[model samples]
Target: MPNPPDYSWSVQAQQPVDYQVSMVQGLLDPSNSSLARACGADGVRKVRCLVVVDDVVDELYGDRFRDYFGAWNIEAAWQPAPGDETAKTLEQAVAITEAMSAMGILRRTEKVIAIGGGVVMDVVGLAASLYRRGIPYVRIPTTLIGQVDAGVGVKTGVNHGHHKNRLGSYCAPTTTLIDTEFLRTVEPRHINNGMAEIIKMALVKDADLFELLEIAMPVVDAGMMADRNPLSIEIIARAIAGMLSELEPNLWESVLERSVDYGHTFSPSLELRADPPLLHGEAVGVDMAICVALAHNRGMLSKEDTDRALRLMCAAGLPVTDAVFTAELVSEALRDAVKHRDGMQRIPLTTGIGSVRFVNDLTDDEIERGLDFVSQWAAEHREETA
Candidate 1:
């Protein structure tokens, strides 16, 4: 048949992704000029930029950013977005693009600046990815979760149809400017929320980072950002590095059997289903707790390590269990995860602190027994945590 007349042609290539995850303090300080340089603001030229700020972040330190642009002779158009879980929606992303259109945003020469928490970062990055078929954006993650976890990675997303992060893209930013100083004013509970990610990294990789977190817990009572001490800074840097190391090799998430998926296997459903909507990190903590119990039950993780992990989570101010984390919910979440993980559970279970082993044969009976163990342990030790 002469190869069916050979009508098909194929093009295979790799899209190179390069983005800097820089740790710099005083990002908004006019004297710093780091952010100005990232936005391509030359000293003599008049540059235009679109700055999207979370409403709460705007109220907290918006004026400083305003002055920063003024000092650098850059024209900034400010767009305020709601700073809540619900803000991660398609509508919000489109609204930011609308603002970009209103400002006549320059495609290649200019960049969009997302200066807020994770939701604002995700929504704005999604807008940038869609606008003009992809534009450069800079992230200045104010919250701890943003700096250590969300800001360091190259993914943009928004929620649809009650699914957490159901719509998203692997759109890397131009650069992510992380300044721990912004976390100084973050709420206590939010600080704990960020700690959950750090703990996840500790559980999955880098035992040294885990010990440092344990040590720093006492001094930095308001979470890692309360005190800019050496211990706190070291812990933050280690956590960021650890997450990036895992992400760099798998930026597109081409590999589903990822250790970084330790707490995330069932977190999407838990995050979306919890009444009042648990924070991303909170949901992850609950899932990690469940997985820890499962690992212990399988003899993959020691009871001592399981107790220590749960205790540390409690000490770090993360919720280890919740009403919505029922066995039925766990079953549903695991089913979804199997589909998400490309037909295998590939669930990451911590065999010991800072190590992980994936298992595909986890059954419903096993999960139920694990949950019962976790419930009993949680009940017995809730009073003794920390």
Candidate 2:
């Protein structure tokens, strides 16, 4: 029997969707060649293209991307390496840029396409933003984290010393292609990492989404117990669609910008304070619960509402508290959140579902209360299994 047709052909058929969320489509199969065709549709020649990917992704998908570009009669070069911490170094960026320049890739003639997870996107996107001022580029995100958050945003950067994404630019991609097939290789823990974003979207934007999440809470809990449930997929896709609706057209707009940062402020600091950095999603889960508690303190959310939110998160297999989320840690995270905000002004805290205001400042006392609530919830449910 003939081998299955290459993943390329199927991807092209789905390209016309507006994908306002950066023209994303969940291709069922990984189609590197199809991606080449999609890029070429805009009239880019292969030889003029420089494809960049993380070392892992390059090893797994580079040949396929190369073959695809070749099939389209395009001249292409693939840069494969861990482009996260190292890429931010001037030496690394300069070296890569110099090599591409030596290959005769000029500002007007070259298009850099990134195919990998968020880190890959950040590094390559920075390269595209900086090379000869700027160059056109595309994004093919391969991880759940990338598909939902990093892949959609124009912000590109690499870690600078200890700070994450410290050096970067707001360079939007020409197009961003998301193929869910790439997730087959993703670990379950990382998938949970991505779910942090999904849950964050539900809390800040869509009451309906939050309700839907509650309905699927059982399936999510089951996932933690080694049970198989297709509902998890449906919930994930629904959550993704809801977020894309808010982000698609206004990616650069400030309104959605603040909304996206809902739980990130406290989340990052939690990770920083932990001996082992918390997974992005895990920290997000904790932050979301904290926000719900904050809302209650501000009298925007009732105790009942806060309890429900915490319960749902636990049902979704996210921990509301960890040893690292001690009372002292919570106070520090709260203070840091206010300090590190876009403006150092007293920021409003969200008080209920769909109610985010900016004037009610949280005191240190309130922060401790929030931390205690999470700790109590964790102890109560520590032995309970889905």
In terms of lDDT, the best-performing candidate is 1
Local accuracy of candidate 2 as per-residue lDDT tens digits, 1-386: 99987665434332222333433343323443445544553334435677777788777777766656656667777677574434555455555676567666767645677877777778777777788877777788887778888887778876655455657777777777776656666666666677677777777766666787777656443233122234555555566676666665665544433666777756766764555656667778888777777677768888777777777777666667766876677666656555556444234355666546564356678778877766766677676312
Residue 271 local lDDT, model 1: 95
In model 1, state the lDDT of residue 307.
86
Mind giving the per-residue lDDT tens digits that candidate 1 earns over 1-386?
36665488899999999889888977877889899999898667989999999999999999998988988989999998997998899999999999999999988898899999989888988999999999999999999999888888888899888678889988899999988888888988788888999999999998898888877776665544745678888888999999999999999999888898889988899899898678999999888888999999989888888888888888888887888888898899889889888999999999899999999999989888888887888889877443
Off by over 4 Å in 2: 1-34, 41-46, 83-99, 217-257, 326-342, 345-351, 384-386
Error of 2 at 219 (Å): 4.4
Provide the lDDT at 7 for model 1.
81
Best by TM-score: 1
How many Å off is the CA of 26 in candidate 1?
1.9
TM-score of each: 0.97, 0.78
Off by over 4 Å in 1: 1-4, 222-226, 384-386
Q: Candidate 2 has what TM-score?
A: 0.78
Q: Model 1 Cα displacement at 206 (Å)?
A: 1.1
